[model samples]
Target chain A: MGDGPSNEKGAQIMSLFEVLTIIVPSTLLTAAPLIFTSLGGVFTERSGVVNIGLEGLMGVGAFTAAVSTLGLEHAGLGDASPWIAILFAAIAGGIFALIHAVVSITFRADQTVSGVALNFLAAGLTIFLVKMIYEGKGQTPYITHNIDKINIPLLSKIPVIGPIFFQQVTYTSYLAIFVSILVWYIIFKTPFGLRLRSVGEHPAAADTLGINVIRMRYIGVVLSGVFGGIGGAVYLVTITSNYNVSTIAGQGFLALAALVFGKWHPIGAMGASLFFGFAQALSITSQQIPYLDRLPSVIMLTAPYVLTLIVLTGFVGRAEAPKADGVPYIKGQR
Target chain B: MIKLVKKINWMTLLVPVISVILGLLCGAVIMLVIGYNPILAYQSIVESIFLQPYYTGETIRAMIPLVLAGLAVAFAFRTGLFNIGVEGQLMAGWLASVACAIVFGHLPRVILLPLSVLAGGAAGALWGYIPGLLKAKFKVHEVISTIMMNYIALYTTAYIIKNFLYTEGERTPTIPAAASLASPFLANLTQGSRLHWGFIVAIIAVVAMWFILWKTTKGYELRAVGFSPDASQYAGMNVSRNIILSLTISGIFAGLGGAMEGLGTYQYMTINSTFTGIGFNGIAVALLGLNTPIGVVLSGALFAGLQTGGLTMQSNAGVPVELIQIIIALIIFFVGSGYVIKWAMGRLTRKGHK
Candidate 1:
């Protein structure tokens, strides 16, 4: 794969091999955050709550992770700071999400409107705190202990798959994929999952079955917060290595899109995240590829969004959400 | 007078007023928690907007696009659709208006100015029409589609500018005087602020929204569909068509808002790495305004004041400008959870009776 090609076919094959090595690992890195956040979306939406504020939740997570890591590193935590910061992010994200859960659940406000408010609040509050904490700076300073990539010991020695999957990758990516499968099990195979889905599908029926509708929804929303927080932290430590207003950008929205595109299933969401991540990878790597570099960069830049639109138009009519999704549960109504 | 007072809907009037006060209070609390003097912060905001001519002018200038953006969101809300694509539509409009102005630089102001603005509306409408069409035909959700389109607009517009209108400073060349909305008279009146003639256009858009939503048969059908799509369909109104029309009209308002920024405020389009955020703020504006035209104007001015005045607060009171954002967000939350307010209000009225 490294030497000069003797023939045209050999050169094409070598390039393909080279491209795979670069693209696969990058795709995993990019998809890791989305995988976590979209799984969060899956939980929230499946419990009949719509969380457009995942973007804001992610922002809160990123900010918390950055600040905590910096603080912990200053406290002489060494390499453990970033990992511990993820837990802090999850707590912050969960607390921030409680605002959405309370407003939409207990207060029975318009869920979408509440979610929008949550986004605004998260964006505003995080930056406001940043300014207050960082001596009026608009962003946080970069943390010293960013999470590093590692190759799996035995797996990195395997022939083709080694370099692509097990080499030079962050453990967080594997954790994200693993969590999605666990979420699928928890959401599909468990009685708790049954109650959660039942509440979303038909709250009155679920209520009749002695299920606590409001409590289930609250749990769903908080879980989303936890997962989304981890996602944001992972992105911060592995990719951005700091927190800024633009650090999370539209990844949360992309995760939401993945959730919808995946038809609200956890594994399906993970698959969709991978696809979107692949599109993102293509855009970033396009300038490096010989033939792809010639095309206008906008095509690659907008591919994920454009492709999501196309995919939705083609298949979303059949993509049904949970029956009572976005509807607040009221006692003894209808 | 007493009878007329009794006939009024106090809840509508009280909810927003209380929400604003509560939002400000929340901002104050946050500031105090952060070791800043909230009183000084708010005082500076008020003083700057009222006492300084430039800040006053800037506040009004800022209100122009905000008013139009609020109308876009409110108009769609009234028609039972969420036009989250306003950001994308605004970008498309910004690009189209500037592109038109630059290309038609030779035309008279009477022809070129309106043409450029109309081009913006057209571009926005076209951008809006896609999601509307998809929703109408394929049942695709507009929220997700519009969100996707925002990115598409961001990247696509950046690409177009880089490829075709490349110039120094990473932005397009300025439009000719004929197409510019800059008014020397307004600038002089505002003490050399960036105030422009777009204010009039925003006022007209507000009135247009009110007229179209309340005075026309099409508007009636649109509102009916919004009230109940199934009932409207059974009553022989075209639900799908109303949905499409609602989003398209919403796009026009959003696009015009963009034109205000492109032709009036800046006079050229710069590639944007993120959304201008006027669209998202429109949601807060519309919600706080209760989706009414008169209400939108008042809320738009209030938000404009906060934003412009926030700079003064930041400079004068050692407070951050983001405090204003927190205040606005709190207002949206308070307004959205009107249930809580109403419940409390109910208890207060009962106590008064006792």
Candidate 2:
């Protein structure tokens, strides 16, 4: 009888560990897309181009990925469908982003307004196309094949850390992490990064140095599109396995918030994305926790956004945008 | 001839007109590509909005909130700010008005209705104040703060409705008739349409917006700051205070929009999982209207007509209502690229001179 109580306590500790294993893996999966998209935001904002149309770009990517995967699967590209879809999505996203570039850069349209319009355009066009393709339906057919989780051969056999990080994790998540680090190095350590930063900070100075400000800005915007597209495609193939109007809902915005909350740094954005991912995972799994069940789930739902606002107000007072950010560069005007 | 042409303000009128035409033309091309009759589609839309009394009333009813929301955006734009939190502010006002109605619903119509609306406006003002204060105090971008505030308002209101005001089926109880904006006289006149007293409220708001923006000394300060904040600061104006006041007033308009929906249209608040697209649409409306008082109402009417007519077009012409959204988006895109249109027009004029 005395051993009964101790046995129950031992089981409780085991269950707690089990709970974490599930939540932590899910959190990484959820955060991978945000990290990629926010890194994209970092690239564009660092080059003095404001990309509020990441949501639209992501939507384009998600829709294109789903549609292309369906076609490729039909053509008998069984295991390779998702990979090919990602490539197609990235291309579509980069092409779509050129609209924002042409409007905001070439025509000197208001960047914010152009972004808003792009979102509406994306939503409308996607739904319209969906209806046309699906014979007056609102969504595409379900994707049969999805990206699978892979276990790292020997690394996943290690202790708790292995299960949390390597076991049963999507390859896309690891790729996202690697890309975040790679983007950080490129932004901070490369000559290209220096030129991009200089153009964002002072276009006149960059122009004086013979750097093509407009061309650099276009490349930054297109890079943002590529990363954001990949992020959306990853989210679709790994998380949802389908494309609808709501597939990329507000994730792009969440990524943007993460970008700003991370103070426009690649590494910081990754951390913020992971934090948001953890919060989302908690919200999904909170019912299983004894104490968490008592708390309202709305708090968790609002946490990422509210926490971002708090961070922006509290810690990021000096989080300055590049000086010439959002201004249309007119030659010889300054 | 030059003086006459200069006095015409052609640039202001031309861009929006040309953009609208271009949007419609593009919409037509899309319909043609889809093997639908664009002319029939457009005619059905026009007939439903104009000839049908019920649809006209519905269109006007829809315009009430949109006009106010546009004013909300336009007000902030005039003060050199973007108030994307209109969605959040509108939502806060919606819940506050409904909550007030539930509490004070026993009172007479005159007292309860106005009180509930004022409560809503006050709640929205509070919601708007957060980002404005953040911008002024911490140098936080209003854009980011306002966007965050939107989600916060979204989840917070959903929680409030679920926990505190749960009537049934993810919606609150309808307000008492005493506090409702529904007018039997207006409804009967409009063939049982949902038109209400909120139309009067919208007109009053428009006049008030005009007066406050053009007639008052505070208006001058707001406009001056919008022109150049540094210049206004050097001229002894408090830039931060103006920013706060501008956002606060914008919040009032947006909050009133929510109040119109609650007391006027639905007569209750439902939990919204997604943002009501009206806030984003208001940005387009404000842009189309050139942020002017009268222009906002006209453009609001135009957009509301498209929406109301879109339903009829869908039913009659076998065209999906999504086409209207595409058209609207195209209009915004064309409007955003007005400089291109201006350049093209300049070339045309120069060619005529040759």
Q: TM-score of model 2 relative to the true fold?
A: 0.97
Residues A21-72, candidate 2: write the lDDT tens digits.
8888888899998998899899888988888888888888888888899999
lDDT against the true structure, each candidate = 0.90, 0.89
**What's the DockQ for every one of the candidates?**
0.80, 0.78
Off by over 4 Å in 2: A1-9, B1-8
Q: TM-score per candidate, in order?
A: 0.97, 0.97
Q: Give per-residue CA lDDT, model 2, range B1-354, as digits (tens).
A: 998687457877889889989999999999999998899999998998889888989999999999999999999999999888899999999899989999887899889999988888888888888888998888778888888998899989999999998888789999999889998888888889999999988999899999998999999999898899999999999999999898899998999999999889999999898888888888989999989989899889989999999999888888888899999988998999999998999889889999
Residues A20-117, model 1: lDDT tens digits: 88888889999999999999999999999999989888988999999999999999998999999999999999998999999999989888888888
How far is A230's C-alpha from truth in model 2 (Å)?
Answer: 1.7
